[model samples]
Target chain A: MKYTEEHEWLRIDGDVVVVGITEHAAEQLGDVVFVELPEIEAVVAKGDEVCVIESVKAASDILAPVDGEIVEVNEALSDNPGLVNEDPQGDAWFFKMKLDDLRVLDDFMTEDEYKDFLG
Target chain B: MSEHSTELKQTPLHALHLELGAKMVPFAGYSMPVQYPMGVMAEHLHTRAHAGLFDVSHMGQVILTPKHDMAALEAGLEALMPVAVSGLAEGRQRYGMFTNAQGGILDDLMFANRGDHLFMVVNAACKAEDIAHMKAHLADVAQVQPVTDRALLALQGPQAETALAALVPDVRAMRFMDVLSVDTLFGALWISRSGYTGEDGFEISVPATTVVDFARLLLDRPEVAAIGLGARDSLRLEAGLCLYGHDIDTGTSPVQAGLVWGIQKSRRTGGAREGGFPGADCILAELADGPAQLRVGLHPQTRAPMREGTEIWDASEGGQKIGCVTSGGFGPSLGAPIAMGYVDSGHASTGTPLWGEVRGKRLPVTVCDLPFRPSTYKR
Candidate 1:
């Protein structure tokens, strides 16, 4: 798993990858009451808003860290959006996508590097 | 009260908020906690189910005592507010507002008749100005004293009475809008059976020096959790209560804002104090003829929350903007997006469908009965 400056984490599973907001992002967002994800088979460019996270306080846009084609979305979140806060990096992932450019992964930060950057 | 907000002021519970891991935000010139570790949703639900203690010390408190007689003091206050203050019984409180000459709201406040004097609490953002306005207007009739020595706390929820009863027994006997002076372990406490969350609750006004320790004593109970301003806003919004600057402002009149209920019968037409307060001509006229626009509950059909300043358009009138959303957010209690906005009187019906423009996208919304959640006040 790697993190981006936009507070999104990418979990690589061979050629397919899963994406979700980071724990720090979830904590900052309070409790997410709604999640708006891009439709499956949608192609998103780097820095494009692929998802929106809404809270009672405010709404935030979650952008794609790299260009990719979305394959699946976590359907469970639509009914129980609080799952993002409970386990943002695991089962509560936003969407899965096949990486269009492998070079974008090199730009992400490692777990230790992201921890240091957050501090 | 300083114009320069570069350095934020801290409340009496600032250190405790930091200890509780609260997310601090700048609000009304103070660095106050917006939410705690429980997050807004859990905190709001907990407040509805159990007790939630809130540090409301940032709100302004003022004590107005008569220099002559009680009636004179009441009349003095009546000159500034639209509510019937002279008739308010002892240990009773009524919601009122400071109206401008054009029938606009300067600020809405809660004024309690304390037998010997009056206790008024105004919004924090406009407190300084409110104090100034009152002092300048009533300097001859009463002594306007701003309460600087007290810290206020709101213990609100279904179990608030049970939690507060452990500290003060008199609280159990009080009903909604009832006020009392009771003694507790820390010091003398003035309690009011009132809160913004539409729950059965109490507002405790205690000495500033001992407030932190006193609040900590209450937090020791399992039924109580410290809630922040974030949940406070949502809870009140769910109850259809207006936020000072957002829902009601200087440009909005009490009648247009759905606050005509606050003005007593005696203050209305054919009553003793009819047409006496500021902007009474316009207010009374609007009361009789109905306001051109009305503040109404807006339910956006979609789950996406429409925020403040979102424009509302007439669905059948070729997208004509009839009003704007003043307060909108996802309601934890309702499990959907709820909002309150001022709309054209023709479009303010309970079932009238409208359109809310959010980020340039039109979202379906309907006018519904206020208080998306029914009030559970222990009246």
Candidate 2:
């Protein structure tokens, strides 16, 4: 698993990368109320804001970590956005991205580096 | 720390807030808590269910003492605003606003008649200007002294009375908007059975020295929890209350803001005393003929929240721009997004379909009656 500077974590699945916000990000955004997911199979750039997250306090956007195509999204978030707060890095994974090269994940932060980045 | 953080003012309960693990943020030049460890959603639900204690000491408190008699001060004050301050009975509080020459609201305030003197609480951001305005206008008739040695705390919820009455048994007799000065173990508490939240509650003004102890006394009760500014905003939004600098501002008139009810008949056209306040011509004419735009509640059809600055359109795909949302967020109690904004008078009716432009998409919204939930104020 690797973490982006934007507090997003990516884990390599079979042929795709599962993307979700880190636990620190979920804790920062109090209670998640709504999540606007990107369309499946949409090509996204590294800086593209793919998802919008609304908490009781304010709204935040989830940026794509790397250039990829969205293959799958967590539809469960439509019924219960609070899952982001309950299990940010587990069941709350936002989407799966099919990247040309999974080697791009090596450029992201390690678990220990993410912890220091949070501090 | 940022230079702005160093300049931020601290409330009397600042230390206590840090002790409670509050995430402090800059609000109106004050270092205030936006939420505690419990978060905004939990605090909002807690306030609705049981009780929530709020530290509102950043708001300005002022005392206006008449130079000669109470009537003199009332007349001086009435000359500035449209409210009926002359007939405010002793130990009663009334909501008011300071108006500008253009009829725009300078600040919304709550003033209570304390027999010989009048006690007023105004918004923190507008405190300096509000004080100058009062002094410049009524210095001859009243002594406008801002109270700096007091802290204001709001205990609000369905169970607020039970927690407050436990501290001062006399609070049981007070109805909504009733104000009283009672002696307590902490200090002399100047309490009013009024609050920003629509719940039955009390706003207690205690000495700054003993305010921490007073807040602790209320928090000791199982029903009371420490609430923060984040939940306070959501609570007021759900209650359909206007927030200063948001729902109402220097450019928004009272009539357009749906605050005409605050103007008593005594100050209206064909009343006992009419048209003495600033911008009386514009305000009175709007009162009689109705404003071009009216502030109305907006209920988004989707789960996505249409926050402040979202444009309201007449059609789903941007046919014509109507107005804009002023205050909006996800309401915890309602489990949905709620908002209030100005719209053309023709589109102000309840159930009228409207569209709020969030991000780049036009989301369907409806003009709904204010107060997404029923207010539980004890009459």
Candidate 3:
């Protein structure tokens, strides 16, 4: 598992990168009520805001972890947005993308590094 | 009192909220629960259908008395507010606003005449500033004391009276805007027939020492469920009630905000037209003709809700930026997207064509009257 400073986590599943919010971020956001995801096939750059997550209190933007072409966007969030709050790491995957350069993962923190960063 | 930094203040019911798995957030410099595990939409719908118990201890409660003469205290309060304080009957409440010299509202507040004493409740965010402002102006004639340790709980819904009647029987007979002293399981409390949400409800003021016991007694009822600030905002929005700093501010007048009814009829017609209240001329004139910019309700053409700060344009005038949305959200009761904003009087009528620019796209909208959902307050 690789994590960004913005609290997004990405897991490489063969050629597709599964992305979702981290537990720490979801806890701070409180109850996740709505999620707006990018369209499939849309090209986004690293650090670009590509998604929005709204809780009861406020809304926050989720940034792209790497320059990539979107392969799959999570449609379940439109109906069951609470999945993000219930399971931020597992069933709440936001989108999958094909990385333009696989080396971008080098800049992300590992699970151990993220635990220390949170402390 | 507990190291007044930027940290959110916790009420006595904080532990109870957390135990209910409420989603907590910072509001008015306090760590408050915005919703419980049920979520905002569900909580809002439930409150309208049943009863919702809300923790409103964050609001500032204060007592005012005469330092010199009793008449002087009433005159001082009346000078600062638009309400006719002198005419208010004992055990009655009145809604009023503090205005600036330009006729803009500084803060909307509730004042109650408690026999020889006056009681008030101000918004959480504006409490400190309001107290300071009142002290600076009325210190010579009146004494202002802040009751920061008190706890305020609101039981709101159609069945609130029924649930509360079991504890305080007379609470059910209290008329709207009336305050009554009732005895409860915990102790004596001041129960007022008023609430922020446009529903039949009561706000109970209890001592800080026994607030927890009082809360637990109400929670024991199966008809009551704990609600948070999230549902509170959505409920009030559906009722077309204004939230300070969003719907009205130090720059918006009562007339523009559709609160002209709060201005007493005697004050409008009597010799008090040129009275020494702040911005009397501007407010009285606006009352006579109408404000240049009027607050109106909006119904978006699509399901996408238009949020605050979304620019509004007139399609007939080259899409000119005429005004901006102040408060907007989905009204579960109305089953549509509703909003309120300031617009030019020419384009403020119902059915006026308007557009809300969101995400570089113009969403078709129409100007409508307020309270998109009819109010069910037991008036």
Best by lDDT: 2
Model 3, B55-134: lDDT tens digits are 99999898998798767887898788666777789999999888889988889999898887889999988899889989
TM-score for each candidate, following the candidate numbering: 0.96, 0.99, 0.87
Which one is best on DockQ?
Answer: 2
- lDDT for B340 (candidate 2): 95
**DockQ for each model:** 0.80, 0.96, 0.25
lDDT of 1 by residue, B301-341 (tens): 88788889999998634669999999999888888999999
Which residue runs does candidate 2 get wrong by more than 4 Å?
A: B1-6
- Tell me the TM-score that candidate 3 gets on chain A alone: 0.96
Interface RMSD of each: 0.9, 0.6, 3.3
- What digit string (tens of lDDT, one per residue) describes model 3 on residues A24-81? 9987876666687898999999878898886655668899888899999889886777
In candidate 3, which residue pairs clash? none
On TM-score, who's better, 1 or 3? 1
Q: Model 2's lDDT to the true fold?
A: 0.95
